[model samples]
Every structure is written in C-alpha cells, then in structure tokens.
Target: RVSMACCLNMCGAVHCSDIAILGYHRKPPMLDHEYMDKMCEIPLAIAACPTAAIKPAKITLPDGKEVKSVSVNEPRCM
Candidate 1:
C-alpha cells in the first residue's frame, strides 16, 4: 500500500504506506507592530515563539512614545 501526506500533518495513512514524508512550516509567522503595541503583550508574545524567531522590536512614535516594530529573525523562524 502507498500513502502520502502533504504537510507533515499526517492526514494520510503514513504508517501503512511503504514510504512516508513529513513536512514542516518553511515560512515564518507575520508580525503586526500596530497590533502588538495596542493589543498584544510584547514579552509574552516573544516567549511564546517555539523557535525564538520573534525578537524585540522598537520604534519611535510621532508622539515620542516607543513603538515596537519588526521582531522577526528569519534564520531562527523555522
């Protein structure tokens, strides 16, 4: 018997199949600075990253308040 799985979710009969393939997330997550500053907790959000991809970003708002921005490490993303 032959079975296949597309993205490592293993929706197919992988074990029953003679061959198996596992996939993972190649692309990293998207980060919205506006969303983060207003609604998300910066430190907690960074810590939640499994791969530590999210780094601390800082930006200066027009009002002189600190605005956080990027927070993504591409090499560390996956």
Candidate 2:
C-alpha cells in the first residue's frame, strides 16, 4: 500500500515507501469565516503572516451588519 502525508508528521506512512510520491497540500486548512472568528484573533494572524497576505476586512452577514475579519491575498499566500 502507498501512503502520503502533507507534512513531516508522516502519519500516512510515507517513510515506508522508498519512492513515495507524497502529496502536498491536497487538503488545505479549514478557514471558514465563522470558525476563524471563534478560533483566533484576526489581528494577530494578520500581523504574524510575514508576507502581509492577510489584511483587515469587514464582512456583511446574513442579517446585513458588517463584522471585522481578515482578508487573504491568494497570490501572496505562497
């Protein structure tokens, strides 16, 4: 059986393969806006990103009020 892992954790058993074609980023992080708000401080995430890919943003909810959030520059994310 072939196994692959995105990172060094090697949980998928890539170490077992002499010629493992390990996959990369096949599963991106879940960054849903609702969860982001609850999970982290947006300002800190923005500041910590060295590439300045994250910026302040205002998102309008279903109720039509704007809320503070972060915006990402996809190209700079690399």
Candidate 3:
C-alpha cells in the first residue's frame, strides 16, 4: 500500500515509499473581476500556476460591462 501527505508537516513517509500519494486541494479559482483588474496582475497569476491551468479570458456581464479576467480550466487544474 502507498501513503503520503499533501504537506511535509502532515506526513513523514513522503520519501521512504515507492509510491507516494500526493494530495491536491481540488477547488475552482474564485475570480473577482473588478478587484482583479485593479489589484492583481493577471499574467503573473497564470504563470504562477504549476499546472498551467489558468488562462486569460474576458467576461461580459448582463449589464454589458466587459471585464477582463482569468479562467481556470477545471479539468487541468490540480
């Protein structure tokens, strides 16, 4: 059997096994367009992802406000 932990603080057998189980926090990225454009750097966020699951995107609200945003590819996300 194989066993592991998501973090070193959580487990000690990460390096001692042939098959180590790595855990992922599976959750979609929460986007706040208004705040994102004002406070965050979109490209930096996308590049920071190890899985490359984030991509640049645009959103059009019902009120016709076009907001620049980032999209998270859920299937590729880990």
* Candidate whose TM-score is highest: 3
Model 3 RMSD to the real structure? 8.6
lDDT of 3 by residue, 1-78 (tens): 477764333343667777887775657656777667778788877766767777998988678999888888888776
Cα-lDDT of candidate 2 = 0.65
lDDT tens digits by residue: candidate 2, 1-78: 666654444545688876565555434344566556777788877766656767888887777867777887767663
How high is the lDDT of residue 9 in model 3? 36
Q: Give per-residue CA lDDT, model 1, range 6-71, as digits (tens).
A: 334354558677887655666865665656777876786566566667778797666787877657
lDDT of residue 8 for candidate 2: 48
Location of the lowest summed lDDT over 10 successive residues in candidate 1: 4-13
Query: On lDDT, who's better, 2 or 3?
Result: 3
Q: Whole-model Cα lDDT per candidate?
A: 0.66, 0.65, 0.71
